[model samples]
Target: MLSFVNTTYLGFENIARKSVYTSLSKDLALKADEQNLTTLAKNAKFSKDEESSFKNTIHFTDFVSNTKISLKISDENLSNLKAKFAGNISLQEDGSYILKKEAESIASGWFADIAYKRGYLKADANNDGKLSDEERKNIYSYYGNGGFYSTSGGNVATVMATEAYSYLRAEEDFRDFTSKSLEEEFNKTLEKDSDFNGEILYGEMMSKGQMIAQAQSYIQNEGYTPPTFLEDMMDQFDQLNKKMLKDLKKLLEEKRLEQEALEKAKKELEKTAEIDIKHSNDQSLDKNLEKIENLKSQNPESQSFKQSLNLKEFSQAYMQSFKVDLKKELILETLKKQNDINYPLDMSKTKIDLKI
Candidate 1:
């Protein structure tokens, strides 16, 4: 029984250890996920002025920027020329293409330009200093007649078309060179095989045909990816929402401070207004005292039994003896026109020797 109990206890211990380990692993994984989300949030946040080009039209790859795309054509395309007509390629019955001429000219232009390495080398057609008139005519005849001095137009076309086939590789002369580039990136692996002297060719590629090629190469015809993750979209949205709440709180705090400042200013203005009012009231009191002094100067003791009192004390004494208005001028006017007042004979005046 003790052995049985020991075995049961060991089993429970193993289960508890496994459970603990399982819980720890889950907790660790969850913590890692949360931490990763935080990092992603930080990186995902864009600046206010950082404009999004998501899905905005942008050129991903340009052929002029990456020209040869691999080429042996220093061509063959020109050798088939009939001189004056820089014509477009034509399609044939055998699913083939050839260059066609627009017009004919006297000289085999290719002989002067392309029969050899073309930088400074030439057949000395016209610029021969030692040649006389007759020799010059002979040189023009030999080069211009287009016999053994030159190749036929179709042969040049075939070589050029073959070269094109080598690179373009499509029968109708094209494969899709554009894609939704911003979704990923242009396949840069293809650029590893390209060969073009971009720096030197910039000034040289000024032809109208080159302009057309450039327009085709750099265009706004692709899709792009916006700032959103399909998988972690919900988490990102939640984080953004939380950020908005934080911003709202910040705005609330700012407005609260502004309101408090306005209230403080209003209180200060009220205090200033109260002080101005008090000063105005004090000025009015001084003016009234001045008026009283003027009245005293105007009135003199003429009667032998005339009574006299200070203005302040007279005002107090008159108030105690009567239930009259507060204006001193009105009380004095009433006293001056005593005939206008008809009162009881016993209550005519106070015993302070005729309170006026």
Candidate 2:
């Protein structure tokens, strides 16, 4: 009975070992597959075809790998792995990849590399694998300006592709068969023009018009017809000039109306001041006349009393005239006080209250 028990225990031990080995082998295979997928994703290039497919498949693969690893790994170990790879990639409930800083940086760099390669190929005018100064300038003008790409679109790849396409199209449109020769001639003509002093004191539209006219005149004097493309450019300049003139006229009209309003306000203020001065003078004159009447009643027959009354009246009038002159300064002070209170005194709206 003891021999039979030992044999049964050995058989059970063998079965347990087989099961453990099977589980270990499966885990190893999953780990290998995860590594392979990650390698494929990191090395994939940005291509016109299968781009979206590669991105989706790789991101999904990464998601699956992380999910499986998270089941067995400690949280600390997983965090260390994420930090090491600079990948804080997360999966949304909708199965979309939420790529944070590192992933975005990688994708942007890739897109920029592709765009530069494509743009350089088109912009090399002599096909010598080197860009001329003019070609470089044109490329910068179209792409270096921030407006070439729309940031409102969330897809960085699509925005970069559009920018590349536009740069190539602009190159084709602006390129002449004579290459940079015509552009050089245009610059030389502008430099020779006495009116164009290599600086634009006026607005941009006016400067552009001057440049276009100068180019046209130079072409005509040399007895050569201007290119159709150049004439189209000139027409665009003309349209811009008309729009600028309209804007300038509207601005000038607004300024003129403002000036007229200010002048009318000044005249009204002067009229109010005159009325205030006249009213003050009449009050002073009445007070002086009353004083003279009182003196006449007090000294009825002094012989020199009339002379005294006349002299007093003349003195009061002279003093009142001096006070009126000082009242101009007082009015200015009152205006300043009103301004401080942001209360404009509109005499037309309310009667003036003279407190002389």
Candidate 3:
């Protein structure tokens, strides 16, 4: 229960913070026009939501703070982008280390061009094909003086891919379409699955950006976002697990009651097996010695067992052998009690004349 509360708290906290970042970003985005924002989009990088957050927090902050604005893509370019960078990609299990190694190789040449364009390499006097320690210091100092450039280095290509991938991965596949159109597109994309129709019965539709914002908002983790497709699978899995867990708990509780009933019945009848292993010190009489043992193990200090009365006095002397347990005894006592269960024994305590 505490865990659930913590998780819920964290989720809402994220929404609040994203409301900060997003609300702030909107004001920041308004400072630039659409054309410039679109151009910034070319160079801007968001560590794909699927990327490991170990280092991406820094990347995300940079993208959010320095990238200046967000822009909506034109439908024509969006189509061409969909053709090139399909939304169906998944992360490699090893955080794509192999792919990163190759990507770094490709990105190795990006800094010189990027730095040159931003005038850092152009300030390279005595041109030794690289920035000296003194030159590097000058570059850092000039960062606030309109020498806008990223220190993203080799991650540029992957960040670009991440942006493209996230852009096209809508809330649901063809989710923006009307319900009638969604049904058509879903059926068209259908392979062999019978239940693959586009009608999701559970949740309202939200786009990739909304999901990312939600993930950032509601999820307590920094720089984590679940894509639309993953959320679809997760929602189904959670529902199934929840139902299965509830059913299993109910079955367990029923089984527990049955076991408790059996124990009490066996104790009432003195039919339980002896502690054959306590051969030298087996001192129990008719096994009623431990009649309260099972209940004691569950609650050793319970007041129910505070009154010690010999079962032999009650069961062996006055009652005939029957399948009834303590529960049945209580019921019959309720039916026959003048005041209560044999509080002070008399002829009135005899419940049935069982000559039958």
Candidate 4:
């Protein structure tokens, strides 16, 4: 999620702009050479391939009046740097300098440092030294930052952490509410032995009308209502049972056809993907065969292509494995090997003797 922290600062003297870019470029180079950001050996190899590929590409200038600046790093160091920041690293189209220090300050450990600290702590409520959701929200609201930290001073550190934490806490609250609601709904539907047995069973086994008739019969026989306890229990049971059945059925049948359609779509997607994969493999094989044929046609015997093309170095590589004049091959091999190694002394340095 970390991107380059790019910021533009306007109005730098031309000399100042050049000096700033030169300093940044030197720092980047030192990091590349000594630190080596790539973790894998294969990554270094990939870097080399990209390095060569860029060299083969042609770049056109947008303006005719623009002058080109040429810079060179050894081929061995080529992979360590690829285009990177050539010449001026900071200048905008309008000729402005970027403030590197401020950019670094904004970008350095922006979220990571705060996230680690926010893990265990909660919002302290009542000054009791313990944290809960309510206390955390209260503290944040009081501080105007909506987090555990105070941001009234307008300091960058407090503002950034408090703001980020406030948003995260709100998200946590929403998720917790959704989960608790689901749990409550599940619990509401749960049946227990106490809900069905003994005194309740006698009432639950009878219909509401039957219970009413029993109560009336008892009332008529005893010349009184007989408290009507069973009647009341039966009525309540009937209402609860009806509600439960309706909810259970609704949950079961909800979106049944939509679920089926989604399953059918998933199967069709898998089938189409299988066909696409087969077609892709077929095309790839054809391309590979074409590349093989082209390579074969460019063999050492292809005199016509050789006369028109300057492919001497490439031809040498192709013929390197074959038995050829040992001396000639060694010389060619040494020259080619030079492209991949660092020589200790500068080849261009000349020793001079002066009479004083």
Candidate 5:
């Protein structure tokens, strides 16, 4: 009876040890899963309150079975068994395994974060988390021109289609998708399509024909049918492109007309300035001629006065016509050499034109 009791006690001890090891392995697995989920929530930009709520609600103790099971296994065997179950177990997207609203938020956040980081989405310049009309237009322009993959040596339409396909597929697989992994797959596809180096050369970049070919190749390879949202986005981008081109053409025409108007105004101002200058010069010449005639009438027979009168008439006829200046010294010399003594003329206030 002593021998049998001892044997039974040993068997119980083995079973208890195995049970403890199994429980410990399960606890470790749950802890790892919790860490991964917390990391995902953090990446999705969860608030501290949200994180706390998530930890309280989504933890293994809250959602999974905790009933201990009987087992008889060695320590080495237990370690092997734990390793076998160490593979990643992802949450489902259908809300069967997780809160539907919370899961959707996380997925949306992840997509937003990826799109922003990869330059496919624009941020609010005012930091208000909302797009203004102008910002919306800019987004349309960006997409019309091909978004982040714009420089990937593909046509705008083809690049846009590729990006749309990749995004939709990733969205569909959001539960298991990560930004890093998605980015890697995108790059791989783009490199294969375009034969990318660090940068694509201008000549090696896709032409419209090449783009069409590559796009067709992509569709065949991925067996992807673009969703309605993607199709709508593509249509919107095309419309935006057409509108932009039309606006650009109209702007160019407006600029051209403005430039022509400015040129015409300048010419008119120059012509008016020339007329005013000529009128002022004509008035000055008329006053000088009147002074000369009065001097000639006062001393009609004086040779010097006659010579001065003749010189004045000659200057008005030739020098004034040619826009030349009359010499003041010559005029003064002619006046000083007057033959008459009865009348003397003061030449002090006489003005001579000096500019041609």
Candidate 6:
């Protein structure tokens, strides 16, 4: 019986046992079966219990590392994290350690404790209003001072209020700085086809052609040119008319000179021709009279001689008179044609004398 009991003890020890007390003790891990102790023992050889324990260990390390809980953070690392949240460092209420301001506020933490007790910091023995130092340290570790202590001679609320005001002022100044730029205003103005304030500049009010026509009409209607004193009033329109008038005057003056040259040439030609014709006629009359005198000497009582002299002499005189009239008519006709051809522009304004 003793040998059999020993072998049974060895077999039972090789298998695992299940217990209700062990199942109740563990809430997270899978427990041994309450109804089937033999099945539990048989499955123990192929169970994941040891592998699960290792997996849990790794999970715990990963969670702690990721959360920075139980793991001490360097100040530089903490500052980098704080910067990501635009956070600042501050002391905790208990003065035990620093806290991140992004985490808590005055409405929470010791204030809650103080208010619950009676709004007095002296009621707490541990200084942080919490019952224990570790709790106070944990609260401080999480909620930092944020410079909000009364005993330290600084008011956290006032500091916070002032910082807020400062931030607002900085924001206002920054906006003003950006809005005061003239470049944007200039670009906007350049983009518009017209002027701002809905007012048109002198140039914008009228077109170039319209303005010129207006000035010309005004000058013509008023029968007046711009005075030197008021020449500054010359705009785009006035300038165009001024140039046109100046050119027209120059051309008219040139034409007048040409007309005078033509007149002089015609007069000279007529005068020379008249002189030649008169000289030729006078010589012919003199030669015919001499011939008549010789004929009279040859026949004193010849009726034919007397009649020829009277008729020939009278015809010569009449021909000379006719030639003089024709020459005068030709000169007059030439002058009339030149005057008609070289008429000045705007004749009503100024007369250009073409007569030489």
Q: For model 1, how does the per-residue alpha-carbon lDDT over 37-65 read when each residue is reduced to its tens digit?
A: 33332232221222322221111111111
Q: Write the per-residue lDDT of candidate 4 for residues 262-332, one digit (tens) a residue.
A: 66875565455445544544454455445445655778457654552347744443333232344434444
Query: Higher-lDDT candidate among 4 and 5?
Result: 5
lDDT of 6 at 350: 28
Model 5 Cα lDDT, one tens digit per residue, 1-356: 00111111111222211110001122233343454433332332212332221222121121112211111223332233234333321244532222233322222232322333222233234433233444333231111011111211222222233221122222322322222222222222233223211222212333444434434444434433433445677689999999999999999999999999976875565455445545655676676667667766788688866676566666664455334223433343443455222223333334466321
lDDT of 6 by residue, 1-356 (tens): 00111111111111111110110111221123322322222222211333221111000011101111111223443344344433434434542233343322211221222212111222223342122332222121110001110111221111110000011111212322111111121122222212112221223323434333333343334422323323344355598999999999999999999999977987686567556655654565555556656777888678876675576765664443333335544654565586564312121342222110
Q: How do the predictions measure up, each by TM-score?
A: 0.22, 0.28, 0.19, 0.21, 0.29, 0.24
Better of 4 and 6 by TM-score: 6
Model 1 residue runs over 4 Å out of place are: 1-230, 301-356
TM-score for candidate 3: 0.19
Regions more than 4 Å wrong, model 6: 1-235, 306-356
Clashing pairs in 2: none
Q: What's the distance in Å from true for residue 301, model 2?
A: 3.2
Q: Could you tell me the lDDT of residue 105 within candidate 6?
A: 23
Q: Write the per-residue lDDT of candidate 3 for residues 231-250, one digit (tens) a residue.
A: 56557999999999999999
TM-score of 1: 0.22
The lDDT ranking, best first, is 2, 5, 6, 3, 4, 1
What are the lDDT scores of the predictions, listed in order?
A: 0.28, 0.37, 0.30, 0.29, 0.35, 0.31
Winning model by lDDT = 2
| Candidate 1 residue pairs in clash (backbone atoms < 3 Å) | none
Question: Model 3: which ten-residue window has the lowest total lDDT?
Answer: 142-151
